[model samples]
Target: MAASGDGISKSDQLDSSPSSPSPASDCAFSSSQSSYMSNAPDPRPDIPSPLENGSMKHHVNGDSGVNGINGQMKATKVGSRSWVGIYESFLMKNASQIASVESTLQHLTYLFPAKFKDAEIASEVVYSALGILGLYHDTILARALSSCPSSAKYQPSLHTRYTRHFTTRNSAYRTIAYMLVVIQKTELLNEIMSRRHGGQRGQHTAILGIESIKATCRLALLRISGTRTLVTPPIPERDIDPNVLDQDGPITHAEAAEEDGDYWMMPRTGQKMPQLKGETDVTRFLMKKVLLPDDVAPSPKLIRPLTTADGRIKEILYILRPLVYALLALLAARLRASKRFKGHYEKVVINWMPWVVGFALEYVCRDGIIDSLSAEGGIRAALTKITGLEKRELEKRSNSMWWWTLRGQFYDSITKPILDKMIKKAENIPLLNLVGLYITDYQYLAETYHFSTSTL
Candidate 1:
């Protein structure tokens, strides 16, 4: 066949057209024919080929090499999806569960010995669960505190319940104390106080709330004194029954005279008792003169209670007035000395003036300083001269500038209103002592160094 210009090669025509039979099909046909001609058993096993098995092993080992890079791409896509689902389901739902957990804690409180027995275990479980769930919150803690009774019904058997199951017993006591003082929960606190007197385990638990108990007592006393009405139960007086004799019988006049001696008699035999010589002896002598017996009878001296108001006032003034006068005199002298020295002394005095004033006022008022001044008198004097220096030092030590900032907040929130009303209504009544009570309370707070600026 001579080649024409068209050429028309059979292989070229087959490759270009869809109607052509494939080479792969021809090869399969040929292999089948060869197998048929051999008539021998096929050599290939029914098990996977060595090449196929090797490819699977590479996939299992997470190897892209040999298996090709496409397999690793498939795996990374699957893993990323799983991680995203887990994070969303666990971490994102935590905020919604906190309230439910807090409610569970409150409900658990009422269950008695059963819960008490495994209280610590229960607490651990709860905390662990909450942490795992990521639901722990401050509101849960505050809710627990507010709901727990300041004075629960006194049940001796429930002592174990409180001791064991109350997870934050100390914090609970402190919170209750703060609330009672803040809210003035007198009746509830009184019940707590009465329960305290029963000498039971429940009371012991309640006594953990001691500040509340004390505040209740003080408020009751003040109310009674202000009203002059015995509305509240009387504070129990310590009884000294005459029939209850000492081991040596009732304190005898002769024995008392021997032990305490006759201060005014000037020693019957003029044999000066060595003991009756000092300032203490002089004080005893003066007391004897003022408290002389009316009759010759040497029976035990009965001390008369002061009946006259003037006499009580005079006694108080006698004890306090001299100290006040001395302090005032000292302050006046310092002022006068500062005036004489003028510029330098003025600066020195000014630097120490606050402390000097603070100390002098504290001495006169019998109050402790908020910040303890240096014991070295000179340094204290120097520091006190600067205005507000004492207060600044106190703020520094206590780390509470809020005290200075919120100076009158407690009074404004609580004391001042009550005092103004009491003053307006009970002007005739001697309620000045109530002011003294406030002063005493303030002094106590200062002495304890509890100047909580946040509280103010």
Candidate 2:
């Protein structure tokens, strides 16, 4: 009555055997036909009727009455077998589809761009893919996050490996740079530092990270001033190249003085060559006429002696300048933190605060210390008067206001543009003090040892 695992029914066998009788020929069959039917044995057990057996079977055996029944049973089994095969095939196909979805999700998670004009749309695609993947392979994503590096160096690796795989129009460098800061990946930070020593690209990444670091420092300073809601992030360890030196060699000095020197008569031979008198005279003439009168000349006036009063003022200015700058910085940072400002405008304010404070301090120092002292006169007055004149001359010589102005100009011309590029590049990396950390480590080691020139 029921089919087995092999999918064949007992009734199916009986229906196909030959020499079986037809249902309508029981009473009127010819003698020869009757004899043939009687001589053949029934393949199936005899039953009272279809109701008794609880199933029906039609004998085939060239029996005319059962022709349609045999055909139908045969067709049904074949069709059933085909349907089972199709179902199994569908299952296997979907298994492969699941794997593909998982692979796509992993790639998307690692390489998702921070900013996109169609970010919501892209995110939907990513989410859908990830959701499908997670349904089958959640462990894969967990493992990736677990294995992620903590240092800054990994940020570039991500930029090169993951970000490039995504949209070509966006910056992979800035995206990973932001992630490195946001995620606070120390391993990635170290990797970034190491790369910085490699080539121009690495150096560029380092410089981008440095801007973020300075902003974080400013924010911290602001918080201390009670004007900012955000606290200053930790300072990163600085990487100081031990080989950097203050010393100048003979060749360096010569090159620096080259504009005034007689190039035509200068050594045109080996390391040391004969010096012509005519060339020496010409150089002397140029030095007096063209170079000496210029700021480029090496003169005593260019090298101001550091006096006790000057040092004291320097200390005061340094302290007061940062204090005032911190206040402004905090105010700007608070605004940013409050979400009242964002993008390029927020950055401009943050960068401008320090320069503004420096300018204000210069104005105060010049007018209060130098100008005020010179106005009071006597023998104690004469010395005070002389010093005040010298101080004012030095102040004028330095063009302190001009220096601040130039600094502001530099911020606008160079720093801001570079910062804009960096911000776009570094998406939302963790706040790791990349530059500070490198510099600190270098300074620490340098202080721990005293080295000879050969050792260096």
- List TM-scores for all candidates, in order: 0.16, 0.22
**Model 2 lDDT, residue 252, Cα:** 27
**Candidate 1: worst-modelled 10 consecutive residues by lDDT:** 229-238
lDDT by residue (394-448, candidate 1, tens digit) is 3443442223322223444455556557655654557675554444433332322
In model 1, how large is the Cα lDDT of residue 50? 37
Deviation of model 1 at 327, angstroms? 39
Best by TM-score: 2
Error of 2 at 154 (Å): 53
lDDT of 1 at 456: 13
Model 2 lDDT tens row, 1-456: 122232221111211122333332221222223333445444344424343453433443435434454445445444545554344334222433444555676566433333445332354456544543342232221122122221111111111222222222335423433343342323233323434366534533443344345445444332332221111111111121111110121222334345455344435543332233566554633432331111221222222233335433542453345345434544654565777666887677666765666566755554333332333452356344433224434445345344342243354566446655655455454543443343333332222211100000
Off by over 4 Å in 1: 1-217, 227-282, 291-456
Tell me, by lDDT, which candidate is best.
2
Error of 1 at 409 (Å): 20
